[model samples]
Target chain A: MSEKRIEISQLGEFGLIDRINRQFTLKNESSLKGIGDDAAVIQASGDECMLVSTDMLVEGIHFDLSYVPIQHLGYKAVAVNVSDIAAMNGKAEQITVSIALSNRFSVEAVDALYQGIKTACENYNVDLVGGDTTSSAAGLVISITVLGRAPKSKIVYRKGAQVNDIICVTGDLGAAFMGLQVLEREKQVFMADPGMQPSLEKYEYMVGRQLKPEARTDIVFDLEEAGVKPTSMIDVSDGLVSELFHLSRHSEVGIRIYEDKVPIDHMTFETAVEFKLDPITCALNGGEDYELLFTIRQEDQEKIKKHPDIHMIGYVHDRKNERVMITKQGNTVPLRAQGWDHFTE
Target chain B: MSEKRIEISQLGEFGLIDRINRQFTLKNESSLKGIGDDAAVIQASGDECMLVSTDMLVEGIHFDLSYVPIQHLGYKAVAVNVSDIAAMNGKAEQITVSIALSNRFSVEAVDALYQGIKTACENYNVDLVGGDTTSSAAGLVISITVLGRAPKSKIVYRKGAQVNDIICVTGDLGAAFMGLQVLEREKQVFMADPGMQPSLEKYEYMVGRQLKPEARTDIVFDLEEAGVKPTSMIDVSDGLVSELFHLSRHSEVGIRIYEDKVPIDHMTFETAVEFKLDPITCALNGGEDYELLFTIRQEDQEKIKKHPDIHMIGYVHDRKNERVMITKQGNTVPLRAQGWDHFTE
Candidate 1:
């Protein structure tokens, strides 16, 4: 055998995905689309299509177990996957969760984790179906796959955005990212002096957003209720700008937005200032918000304009290969996707 | 923190699963069923129901990297999930695959794995939709979730079997187990003397069964074509006797089988003998065959008797609590389930 070795970090996550995806091609008629999307869409019988999405959360990388409750971790796992399904404009019906844990977790700990998972299942109205529980050599790993259903006419893809579609997002961004910073700070403080109780009561909302984010399934339902179908959609898992680039690339369109329109909670803004992180940058690049980002026809805007949670931040444009954001100070600059890159430092 | 530590092996795999599942309760109308079955069935908009199944394969416990190819591992991961969908008597439509690997893996290694995944997706006629790629601290882990669809009338569950139903299974068993034994033996031999070539040619058939076991999707198709819906169905992932126990427990029906009727391939039998193992025992207790086990109404037997791969093994009985096996010597004994228990010694 040859003694050549190559590290995965050299290729990075996206490079690795590209390499792997290049070898496989879809073979089934039922498989409407594969890989390179928020969720995979399958051709189901009748006028409905089935959407499938999967996500894996690893200990240390995705969350720090020191501060994250096992139950919240479980709930967050399901929520993230459901968020992906919601990104495809589908209602999640079922989810299967697989976890690999070390011996450090007790039966009580396992129960707590399941409690969170059960709560999320209830909240999202999805059934917890089949999953495998196994032992891991290291920290915990949670992988969940969610199944969703959407009418063919209402189903949205990342590639369906038109040149002039209005870009919309649900809920405020950057809270989850800021919440993570607070948690990490508290953890460090607790570690340094065991006697000092970390003050977290004032940051309850941000902390909740970080520890247990909710999937925007309600937005999916509201879109249907308002008789509006998003031309393109994606859940904000990898920052707002990263997901926007995905939509722009897949739909072959350009995007332009105003920084003032990006929703950022007041607490998040204050916390960002305290943490010495730019509020706008955090909103654009800090991910795990579980908010829906989509495009709507200009005529349909009137229907969802009344929704308090939905924020119209940008518009799709015909200028291909350009995605820019206008600053509050009147400077226009190109948007770069500095999303979460797990591989590179 | 008080120093109280418990090893996961203390509770074992099933015990852990039970502990985790006990905390979750279904709350959605769309969640027709959850956790316990081969797949979770969800109510879709149409007459058809959606099925979801998930499986996780861990390194060292599930596969040995020394002998197993990464590509085959990927294929097996998808195949196992497809088998779960087939057990529900549904047509698999979409799958989400999540992989976690350490930096030791190369871009080429990742490609090999996905190549196998893509091949299986094509062969099973299922689409690979969405998944997560993350870095791991240890060996590679693959988790797959499959989504399937079938009309409510055609869906089969483990609890549907009745007394007097004919018990049937597709393809031969024990080949994969025997193949694993052969591989282990060769690995030992090669480890002891690097210059000696592996005596693998004679065990090629058995080895293939271990390396690339196909899911019994064809049985699902054949049953549909024959217009015979199984009263109860399950895939043989854990040994045959274990699966029998599952059917018996779920359907609340007794089962009786003849040892002579169990299908054992010629290569498996020969290899088992060479390894000083019982072929019948291997057929009963060996796993990873990915075969289908089902019960059919006695009157419908005539329709499938002509099918080449499907084999009649036994019949369901009114003795709900008794599950027995008849030996070649005319002796009857209770069957024990010693399936793949990773936690057991």
Candidate 2:
């Protein structure tokens, strides 16, 4: 009872992970790489490597069942875990999804959830290998572990980025953030007036981004086909600036991205304006857009220079801790990341 | 909403798994086997194969924080997952433990939980490769996925037990169930009078078994050393009779286990009597023992006959649907499995 008490918020989520992960070292030889990557890398047979990643989504903290459909929840859960494997430039082959839910969820509800999971498996060409379902004392919890593989030569790590490498991102950023905003606004309106019906037709694009995000596995295949392997890669689940910080720290290089070059969907920008928020800030700091961010060597830039889905945003610098963004009016600003800190009150 | 109100309890856990797993087929060549086992089998190179399994433990549903220490909960969680690998006759190499917890847990509490996880990792020689830690809106949720490997020749499944195979079990049975009964009794007493000190001196063994159940990985090593391969193997988590039912159903063989041969610690028997419960019934149907149950070919039984820990219980029979138990009094009774159905109110 007299033991010391420390608030988890004092050491945020990242700090907490660092503290815990520091105590353990990779002991198994097959464990090629452990904590601190999008996915752990393992030595597989045939001189290939495997990628393993797991994510747990809690109902109330991660999603509100009242607004988010169970089907989309199931799909998003699979997509985010697959995004981790894709971040390692690997194709996810199998996934195990375990869920814990209370009796409030019916058999039909579970069917709807699995239908979406099956849909994702078909979409990504992944197989559902195994999972456990147990009763929860409270709200629903879904945890998915994905196993993937790539040839040893094709595998990439966050520490592979180098000076002058092009920093590229797949798909537009901030749309999913804007989508969440619209969903929240609509939920409030509906809550305030119970008899009023919600109209989501106009905001479907943005809402869908938040409800059903997809992993950019196709881009991994495209890069392999084009014979351009990214030097370093990470999934953009924690906002552009936050993931950039990860790549910079691990690769020990600085980065400079132009704000004007940051990709933003038309609807995202429009919604940002309507919400009286800055589109650029949302693109830089809003999370949950499961896009791939990676750096490519200068010589490989011509391989996919005209690829419409890929956007070249910046270049890596030589010095670490010197990340910046050039504004449209020739002003350079230090990029700030207000990433999610769930532990913080 | 009118589609279906079928209760999950109607199908039961195994039936629900059957209903769900029947819809999906393994599409990837690397997926050697999917579902219907303690772990999933995946094709690995070098004449070996890999095993993967997952288990999710919800806080209130799986453990009562008031009586269960967080550290032991963490240790037991990892141990149970490792037991799944051992059930497949494989060595667990890596595990990803993802947890979602609310702010009620402090930094010190999280540290205590990780201390147990780290201890288990060191004890089992399994690497903690990767995991996701997120905030839960309510109670704590821990989901662990383990990856293991074994030579193809050594791998064992539940379907391989043949008629006349000698059934074996590792370690004593039903102590953990007795342990839970002891703990729950002490908890009720303490709750009735908070000032009363819990007299757990005499119940240390049972209490330990309940709080810290160790996986029988040693039996796997012993079997290998003895050059004996179990025709089929499974971990006895949900009571001995339930596991026997699984082995019987999967192997398409009936089972005849002698009640006199079911190993029960003397303390467990006496404690069951103290709790006004039948000792044999407790050994047969009480869950969470985490023992290894298997069937060895009659010729291979001699190799492990003298193994100090392994107990030869009975034999597999030819009649697929006829399972029975021979009591010490020389009477026979049909074996029944009142398995753990968490969905039941």
Candidate 3:
């Protein structure tokens, strides 16, 4: 109640997370890993470790209901949390979703949301095991907790990357950010002239990327099929550079990546140019990619090197706390993290 | 898009829950239970069961910053979910807390919130696991998920009560509801006259009940110590009678309780009388007690009859869905559920 007003923006999201992590210590033996990595690892039955991760999405702040379909919002909610479990090199099996909605929402609206949740459950083979639904004072809120499992030997941590490990990523990046840009611009156009039909035909793929992002559980499967256990793994929810910084900090290693090797979809690149923005910048800092970024030892690279979806982008180095990008012009530059920070915005 | 507007209030909370429960079927073998209970039960390793429960508290909807301390709100959030785990006769081992706050709050405010969270974790002996922290466009929102474990043979569910089982509850009830009433009244008084200093000394117990309710994990420990496995169990969250209706519905049995047997704290009774409200009505309909309500086999009655905090208020009967209360004068009246429903409010 004191007037000492220190804005949350001053500390930012990761700084606030660090402050939170330092305050609590794990007391229970079952809690193998606490407030670090993508999920908390707990001792389960036999030689397997259970994985738990949580994500919360707020309406208006995280999504504008005007442009976002309720069904897609529900599916994205589940997918993001499942992606955290996938980041731990585990298979998500169950999810508990909690939503708080204002009465302006109808029963039909609720059903539409659940339809999306059920769709995600079917696609990911994850069961909707538990959830809490309540009335909110304002906008809708969705919080999901995903439960997953992996063998103790196979479970990966963000701190396991070592020097000479090959860094890999799944699919492409920045499409979702471009998709959001197109949607926002189209919404503005529609608002200015209600009679004018917005031309969205050419931006379908980008729009879909923004409207519905999928968790890369398939990559987790592929890694298993290739018999490669990633030395370190993390999901790319908070952009490429930010996540790379997390891996670097946690693993006590440095990163050296070729900027040209970073995968960017053609649609994403063209749209960035149309918007008068740098495509590389979008790829590096556009959050919510929901792709997998991981590292494997040099000896293990042959297993997934030829896999079409997997792209080798970088290597871990001995110099700790350093990250750089080698450009197509053969120039090295320091990497900066400009990931999503909802508080400041 | 349809002109049809079916307000969520039409179905009510339980009706809405039933609608949600009907939509999702448990697909995985690990998922043993979903919805309709205090917590969901999942299969754990080595003949053990894991209990998962979630609760979300939205500011303005669930609490008011004017009268409720931020720290107490943080503690109450964690306690409610831990109480759900205890309802299943399980020990809560880990909890994930996710919170969203607007910029109106400061870094010191967040620290106060987490300070309360850390206090509760130490008190309950539960680990602070993984969670998400984001920004809300409006007021604060806290969502907590508690994970617990119990032996397969020991885990209690709501659907296990049988005829002639003694219905019992731990500690007292109805105090928390009265506490909220007192706090709201005091808040209104202060708002009406800015210069007026509100008096709350006489209502400390009720105020404490509303602000810092504790989870009855001690009862869980006691039941283990007494070698008593409750046939059915639930936490007293939404008043005594409403939770009784749930027991009757789930166990497929009738409930009959003596009005005089319901435990009411002395301070709670006095405060209700001073407010010109019926104490018994408050006892039956007042909620947020965080107490354990369970049914023990008649044969196990002797084990806990002398236990100071345990109060036997009712018994299970064969006539399904017939819930009644016997007055102090021996008159029988049907019991109705008017428990907390935020949507209708």
Candidate 4:
């Protein structure tokens, strides 16, 4: 109530997280890892540990209901949380979804949302265990918490990447961002002329990437089947270079990558150019891709080298503060983390 | 998108919850129970099992900032979720707190909110594990998921109550509802006259109950010390009568109670009288008390009869579909569930 005000934008999202993380220390021994990881690790029993992660998606900030179907929003909410567990090299077993909505949403609309949630639960093989549903004063808000499990020995953290570890990523990047761009354009066109049917047939793949991104739980099992374990892992929710910064900070190492090695789908590239955006820049800075960005020891590289989806994009090095990218034209330049920051935006 | 519309208010809160619950069946062996109790039960390991519960609080729907301090809001949010774990006869070990706030909240306000969360964590000995922070388009929203553990042998469920079991409630009821009346009255007074100072000295206890209700976790410890395992239990969050209906429906039994035996604080009774409200009706339907309501076998009555805070008010019977209360005037009346339904409101 005082006149003194400090805007949250000044701290940004990461700065605000740091401010909170500094205040609480883990007191329980069951809490193996606390705030700094992709998910908190709790000792379940003996050599097994539980992974817990949560995500909150607000209506206007996280999604535009005009273009996003209610069902896809529900599915995406669960997938994003499951993706967090996968980032820790664990399989999500259960999820609790809490939703708040205004009366503007109908009962049939609620049914469609749950239909999508049920589909995601079946797809991920995760139980829809519990949740709280309450009415909101405004738009819809969905918050999901996922529970996962992994053997303590196999659980990977973002801080374990050693120097010379081969950096790997699952699937291509920047497609979801491009998909959002296409949706926004279509939404604008439709808004300007209500009778106009925005043709999205050409951009269906990119639109699907934006509307219903899938969690790469398959990649976790594939890595295990290939007899390889990532030294460090994180999901690419906040663009490629931004997540690389997270791994570099946690592992206390430097990153060196090649622009040409970074995988981008031809469709995504063509769409980015059509929108007057740089494809590689979009890959580096666009958010919500939900792919796995991880590092494996150099010795383990041969194990997954033949895998089609896994791309060796970069390597870790001893220089702790240096993160550079070798361009397609053989120019070495510093990589900027233009990841999504909702608070500042 | 359809011309045929079904309003959510038509189904109400419980009705909507039932619609969603009917869609998903628990598929995992680790998931012991889902969507029908205070917390979901999951198989942890060996004799231990885990309890998971979540609650989402919206700004205008759950609290009004003009009267409720940000710190108390934070504390109450955690306490309510912790109470759910207690309702399952388990001790909460870790919690994930997700918050979404608009730019209307300052950095200092966020700091205050976390401070309250930190205090609750220390008081309850719960570890702050993992959470998500995002921007909201409107007011602040907090969603918390609490994780707890208990021996499988000791875990309690709502369906475990038996005929002739003594029903018990902890602390007093209706005080929180009285507190809200006082706050709302004072707000109206202040709105009519800006220079008028709200007089709250006499209603401090009730007001505190509304703003910062504490979970009856100590009662769980006391029951363990007394060696009395409740046959069934639930937190008194939706008033005494509504929660009793829950126990009746889950256990398929009848409930009989004495109006004179239901615990009501002197201050709460006096305040309700001053406001021209029936003290007994307020006690039966007033919510947010955060007290424990459970049923115990007749043989265990001797174990906790002398405990000052634990009140024996009723008994369960085999006559299903009959839930009644005996009045002080010697009249038999069926109890009605006027529990708070945010959707209908």
The per-residue C-alpha lDDT of model 1 at residue A274 equals 92
Q: Which ten residues in a row have the lowest lDDT in candidate 1 chain B?
A: B1-10
List the candidates ranked by DockQ, beginning with the highest: 4, 2, 3, 1
| Quality of model 1 by C-alpha lDDT | 0.88
**Alpha-carbon RMSD to native, per candidate:** 2.4, 1.2, 1.2, 0.9
* Residue A92 local lDDT, model 3: 93
Residue pairs clashing, model 1? none
What are the per-residue Cα lDDT tens digits for candidate 4 across B183-220? Answer: 99999999999899999999999999999999888999
Per-residue CA lDDT of model 3 for A218-330, tens digit only, reads 89888898999999999998899999999999999999999999999998999999999999999999888999999999999888889999999999999986799999899
What lDDT does each candidate get? 0.88, 0.91, 0.91, 0.94
Number of the candidate with higher DockQ, 1 or 2: 2
Which of 2 and 4 is ahead in TM-score? 4
Q: What DockQ would you assign to candidate 1?
A: 0.58
| Candidate 1 CAPRI-style tier | medium
lDDT of 4 by residue, A1-345 (tens): 487898899999999999999999999989999999899999988998889999999999999999999999999999999999999999999999999999899988899899899999999999999998899999999999999999999999999999999999989999999999999999899999999998998899889999999999999999999999899999999999999999999999999999999999999999999999999999898889999999999899889999999999999999989999999999999999999999998
Docking quality category of candidate 4 according to DockQ thresholds? high
Better candidate by DockQ, 1 or 4 = 4
Residue B28, model 1, lDDT: 69
Q: Write the per-residue lDDT of candidate 1 for residues B73-181, one digit (tens) a residue.
A: 9989999999999999998877778898887777778778888988898898887766889988788889988888888888999998999999999999999999899
Better model by DockQ: candidate 3 vs candidate 4: 4
